[model samples]
Target: MRVLFTVYPNSLAHLYPVVPLAWALQSAGHEVRIAAHHSSAELITKTGLTPVLLGDPDQPPVRLTDDCAPPHHQDIVNRYADVMGLSPEGREHWIVFYQWLMQPTSDYVRLDRSEAEDLIEFARVWKPDLISWDATIPAAAVAAKVCGAAHTRLLIGHDMFGWSLDRLAENESALKAAGLDPNPLATLIRPLAAKYGYEVDDELLVGQWSIETMLEGLRLPTSTKKLPMRHVPYVDPEPFPKWLYERPEATRCECCGRKNRRRVALSLGESTRRFIKGDWDRAPKIIKALGELDDLEIVATLDKAQLADVEEIPPNVKVIDWVNLPHLLPTCSALIHHGGIGTYSSAVAHKVPQLVCDVEGVSLLMRLVEDGDVNKTGTYRLGWEFDEREEGAPDAATAHWELPAKKVESTVVSDFVISTGAGVRLDHRATTVEEIRDLVWSVATNPCYRHAAAALHDDWLAMPSPSDVIPDLEKLVVQHRR
Candidate 1:
């Protein structure tokens, strides 16, 4: 059977999750091709899969405007929250973040009509047996429908999109009462679907089913039938640097005396490293403060761009541009990182304790931008708390005073870490360097964190690996394909 894979071309983060499974299908003698924007052709080739380019490499990237997003996005979010009966804090944790997330899939932003037509034309010519796409790409669903192919979303994290669509369906009466269409996903896809001479439907929007890498415990409340698989970490292959294997103690007399010192992997995750320009002011501060510990060696996976603000490199810290997490994580005592699924899953797979930091503030600002407040921006700071007793709302203490305390993905992962006793979640935006130092030390030295991490590792190991789940995927394709 021929299988076609598709993902949004915005980043490799979306592409990486599906590679292992694509490889698994290929190993089982199926033909597989990855279709993405032309910009990602090189990356697709790097994964050892055939590439199907969908759009012109020179085309300006698709973008959404503020005028197009806010009102409709907020309405859908509010309705979904109402149907879910979320609490105030629950709304903050997920719904608010999702409102900001809705921009990407909004009516404004999507694959160019020409690019999408390109995909549909390819599907027609290729007649793929199945189309597995990133959850963010609804146009692939349209192509699958037009081509009579089975389709499923390949989720890298939580199933927020699926969950929202499910909520809308389950509360059809309430939505109708409110004078709204229950199937917002279908509504969003209608313009494109109509072009293909088909009416929009749930199967095209949500897929016949989905494949997810998140453990069952981390899953959201969604009615979509999903198959769970263990996340296999894959990075663009890089040659090992000679210094990586050499023990630091051999080169410096100072390191030889601190035999008790532990090694910690410090990274801001790929999204931050690739997308965030300039250093996050907090990165240098955290590295320097953690470096002050006499009993630690910090391996910071950061490039020169991220370290531009640092006046001095700490003697105990080794800053490198890149190192594969699967290679370096096993040697580390703990991980301190932005809560990207790639980094979080790598640490869990390697049984390393973790300290996950703030990701919500940026999402909060995203809400402001979508609401047409583009000029309102602030430097993200750590360590503020609101006194509940004094609240209606607090006055601005600094630039962009109201920062979100949580982002949906980070909060979910961090909560699981805390619940399992495997790590700590640094929730405060205003957390001090001293506080971070203590948290890092606690998770690294505490055997409880190690035991908890091992337990989590055992759970992760129990999930079916890519190669192990090949039969299930084949069965599903057989069952769902026309």
Candidate 2:
């Protein structure tokens, strides 16, 4: 079978799963082609798949222009200098803020349309049997419709179906207003029925041929409820190495050349950094905390800009600009992150205990932590509060009062730390010079935390790999193709 995989170009999350799936299909002797932004072409090619550039050719590259200064600095500038005066809730204020923040993303999406048209043209020529797509890329759905192929939506995070329905409906309305059909699922069955000169009910089109049909086609196990809204599925834990369970004491991986077996990993994705900046002095805090640790090796995956910001590097800290985390994580201790779903899932698959630091409500890290799937570490700036004296000044006092350092409700850090097989949740109150030094020493030198983390890792490694249970995801693909 030949497959065309379409994905959103904004982030790495959409690209990761596609790579593994493409590899799986290729190993099974199927031809797989990828359609994405030119920026992601290299990434796709690295996975040994052919990349087809979609959308506009003349679109300019996007740049990050926000002052690398802290949020307080930016807020001050916005309040004193900008006309909006820090009233983010106001329509005009939001318009300017979002336009500034999202300008690059908007430009990228605009370019994506031209690329999508190119993909549609390619599909016309190549005539693939199946199309798989990241749910965010509507263009993929359009191409799938144009090519008369079966389409499956991949969810990178939690199942997007439940709370996403309203957003989907809104998008559908916008597309319809723009004189497009808006429903890719309808394009297939409705067009065929039209060709036979028959009328079809829209409800049946959506219920039978749209969302429900697509889910059924995927061969996903059914939930107790019939409605999509009631049937959001939990992500299954990922599989790890079998040897991890047999030998709980085994920290070093013989297969991969990793040593000094601290099992925890940290993902410093861009969004997480932004959130941290809003709350406190991120750079100094991280440096202070990490500097105190001598026994445990702290591995941080950071971008070049962030790497450059580190003035003094700790001897035990290993900094890599990028890594194949799925390949690297099983060898580590636990995952400490600003909660992104991709990172969360990767940690879960390895059964690595999560110390989540939520920077934004856009990501559901807090929700997951509250549910006991992962341990929550910190609070986010929900929004700015207002004061009567200064109209635009941030309600800094409210933020200070409301935001907890870590999300774990327990009074004892030891209990929270030892019970979950994860590291100590850093208390913002205790994040002063002396407290940071003590906490880092405690986490790094503590044997119990490592033991708990290793035990969890062992449990994760014992699970059956998808290869063992599903054997062939292609069968699911083929069934959906019909």
Candidate 3:
């Protein structure tokens, strides 16, 4: 069977997962082609797939330029800037930020439509058996509908788009424009059947649409009569550090190759960029705390701007501009991160304890730690808290104190310290340069965290392969043809 895989172009996240699935289909003796933004053509080609460029070459890139203060400092300006110009007002400031957040997908949707028009022109000449699309690609469903082909959504992280459609029934207008209804399952399956001029039984659509509903509906196995749905497919690169396999037996740190070296991985998501940029002063304090540690090597994944603000590169720290984290995280001791779904899943896949720094919304980190027996496995929890000072409480003390004591909270503080578990709860108030030094020494000298980390690593390595969870792709092709 011949298949056309579609993705949104902007960054590596949308492209990476689709590659392996395309490769898997190709390896199964199916012809596969990929369509994406021109910027990502090289990356798609690197995956050994043919690239179909999606947008006009002369079109300008979507620029998210705004005049307000950076995100970290938004709270400071937002409090007083209400009296300022319209651009600086708190309400207007958030509107700009929200627009920036949606810019990538919004821009890609325009390109997807342009690309789909081209694909429709192409399909009139060369037909494909099926069309598999990344969740971000807005046009693939429509293209499949117009071309009369099977359509399937290949998820990378959580199904954000599908979830949004379900949560905000207000998206009915957008769905209608895309030829879908408010019903997610029908929104997905009906288009393909209509395009193909075939009568699809509701049962087959339900069975095939399991991946979409299982995740979006938030229905766990015990709560529903439906069979457990397969997890999203991920291609794990091999030749991983042997310690990941030998875990409890390999009593040494994988990165430093030292039994004395304490291992921890810091996975920075997009939210970290927002918080760090908003509060520029906190960078120095974070650096000072990191610098004091001799035994601790802070492996931080940061964006270009965040890396620029980091003045001194301490010997104990390794900064990677970008990396394949899903490949690198399994060998780490613990993870410190902003709680994005990708980072969360990587930590879970490795079974490593996590320190989540939630900068917005209700504290997801606290909820997870409180609900689960995380302390037993050594997961730590901490978050930035904010309380508006009434009148004149105190002037800003230092970079550390500028955040104020009321602005930070920990749910499982004592459990982290006394439990001898796999995680450490770094108190934002007390985590001074000197304390960070001592904690690093303790983690390096102690054996408990490493022991637990290794045990968890081995268990993850023993789980069923991601490929095994789904029906064979070869079988899907045969069934579709029949």
* Candidate 1: residue 278 lDDT (0-100): 40
Give one digit per residue, the lDDT tens place, for model 2 in 1-482.
78888766534555765665566567777788988766666667665679887654454223221211112223322322233222222322222222222222233223323554577679878988777665445445555556666665544433323222323244665555555444333343343334334444332222212222111222222221221211111222345435333322324556885544453455655443333323233444665566665545567776544454456777666666565566666666555664444554465455455555532212111211122211112333323211112224333323321233332212222233345655555443445767655655555446675566666445444543323322334554455453
Task: Rank the candidate models, highest TM-score first.
Answer: 1, 3, 2
lDDT to native, each model: 0.71, 0.45, 0.46
- After superposition, candidate 2 runs with Cα above 4 Å error: 61-113, 166-265, 270-280, 307-311, 326-331, 359-482
Q: What are the models' TM-scores?
A: 0.84, 0.56, 0.58
Best by TM-score: 1
lDDT (10s digit) by residue, model 1, range 35-147: 87776788888878888887666753343111224322445666666766666645644463355445456522253435687888999999999999876677888889888
Q: Once model 3 is optimally superposed onto the true structure by TM-score, how far is the C-alpha of residue 104 displaced, in angstroms?
A: 4.1
Q: Name the lDDT value of residue 359 in candidate 2.
A: 25
Runs in model 1 deviating more than 4 A are: 63-85, 89-98, 106-112, 179-181, 247-258, 273-275, 278-281, 308-311, 359-365, 369-408, 428-430
Query: Candidate 3: which stretches are off by over 4 Å?
Result: 60-104, 108-113, 123-125, 168-259, 270-283, 326-331, 360-466, 469-482
Greater lDDT among 1 and 2 belongs to 1
Model 3 agreement with the true structure over 260-342: per-residue lDDT tens digits: 54556665554334323322333345556666755556677766545545678787667775555666665566666544445
TM-score, cand. 3: 0.58
